[model samples]
Target: MRLIQINKTYGDKTVLKDVTLDFPIGKVTVLVGPSGSGKSTILRSLNFLVTPESGQYDFNDHQIDFSQSISNKEKLAVRRETGMVFQDYNLFPHKTVLGNIIEGPTQVLKMGKKQAIKVAKELLAKVGLADYGDVYPSELSGGQAQRVAIARALAMKPRYVLLDEPTSALDPELELSVLKVLLQLAHEKQSMVLVTHNMAFAKQIADKIIFVENGEIIYDGDPKKFFSQDNSSKRIKNFIASMTMENLK
Candidate 1:
């Protein structure tokens, strides 16, 4: 999937300025930046959740022109290929874990209920939540709920899994659980685009890193170089130092 010359704004404030990015297949691409730097918007635009004012988005056989009015069908098609996991788990409060995971498969994919449930079970196990299928979102801890959310996203079998700060809402211990699932996915070569604040985790899992600041990309290359104190830009060095300090606190 690729975005070319993308530009987005809200009134007088420009969020993304001619941003072009590529998400390689079977690789984990991590987006790291300070707050309000347009990382989340870039993540959301993958599934058309946050439309840009102008640009081209190419995914598989679909090429979307953001300057034109997008049809609902076009939007749905893009979303079908991309699974989004937000900062918040966003699970259905009234639904059980099994129900939440199977909803998209059974409804949108038109899989049989039994088949959807079967696939959901496998995904739940993959995320280390095999026994929690009958449990409701309200009953699960922060980490458990996020795992279920991951399972729900996986059950769709999307081509690219887009995560917007998936572990940000949890404490460090709980964050580790979610990170483990993500690391496992990376090991299995699942293509993904992630927006995250965890520099340590980003260095560990990223195949490519894109650093954004003030809605512009400051760096887009090797994670090793991005994290290297001596090699990175002064701005990036300061940013990393600040983030590291914040993490220590």
Candidate 2:
């Protein structure tokens, strides 16, 4: 996806300001920055969850303006190729793991019930939650819950996966488990945009690291140079310092 001078505002508060960037295809890219720096806003804008005030978004060769009036059907078609996972699992309390994964495909995609269940079972195993399909979300650990969430997103067969603070709500142990799954996914599939504070993981797996500050991208390139000690930008340095301390503590 390509974003050209994307801009967004809420009343007088500008959440994203002329942010321009290209997400390399078939690679895992990381967006790292301070909280409320518009990383999440960029993700939301990509999926049109939040419309931008100005600029163009190019997806699969189609360029669209956020200000243009788009039909719900058109938006839904775009959603089919993009999957989003949030910090919260957002699974239904009343549904079984199996139920949650199959609901969308069977209902929205109009897949047969048996076919959806067949697909769900395979995804469950792939995510390492093969035995948890019959269980409720309440019975699973945070990591397991998040895995199911990821699997549910995958069940839709999206081309691009967008993650927002995926491990923030988990404990250390659970967080590690979830992070491992994310790494596995990144290695297994080539397309994903991860918005996270995990610098270590970004350094390890990201093809490119994007640094956003105060609703704009200050830098976008190799992780090593972006986080280097010689980098004298106060905003970038402060963000790296704070994340390092948080991880250390």
Candidate 3:
């Protein structure tokens, strides 16, 4: 998936300016930066959750242009290939875990209950929540709930799973369980775009890291070099210094 010449503006505030970057297939790209730098906006624009003022997006054979008006069929097609996991679990309060997971498959994809439930059960087990399918969202711990959310996203069998600060809502103690599941996904080579404040986890999982500030991409390259990376901007270097695990520890 690739985004080119992306631009966005909110009144006087220009959120994204001529942003272009490639998300290599089956690889994880982690976005990091100070709050309000528009990292999340970049993620949101990928599926047109927040459309860009102008840009071109290409994911496999599907290409979209924000420069022209887009139809609902185009929008639905983009959404069909992607899934998003939020900081808050975003599970339906009235629904059981299995109900939440199967909703997308049964309703949107027109899949039958037997197949959806069978797939849901396998995904639940993958997230280490096989037995919790019968339980309500309120009954699970923060980590467990987030795991269910991950499972819900995977139930769609999307090509890419976009996460916005998925671990941010969990307590420090509960973060590991969620991270463990993510690491497993990493091992299985799932493609993902993640916006996060957790530098340690970013360092661990990111194949590439993009640092943004003031609504522009300042750095876009390898994660291995990002920690010790010395780029053109001193301000970005300082920001990296502050967020690196060495400084945190």
Cα lDDT computed for each candidate against the true fold: 0.92, 0.87, 0.90
lDDT for model 2 comes to 0.87
> Candidate 2: misplaced stretches above 4 Å?
230-234, 246-249
Off by over 4 Å in 3: 229-233, 244-249
Tell me the TM-score of each prediction against the true structure.
0.97, 0.94, 0.95
- lDDT: worst 10-residue window of model 1: 240-249
Candidate ordering by TM-score (highest first): 1, 3, 2
Clashing pairs in 3: none
Strongest candidate by TM-score: 1
Clashes of 1: 0
Q: What would the per-residue lDDT of candidate 2 be over residues 33-135, giving only the tens digit for each residue? A: 8888899999888787888988988889567887788778767877887888889989998999999999889888999999999999999998888888899
- Candidates arranged by lDDT, highest first: 1, 3, 2
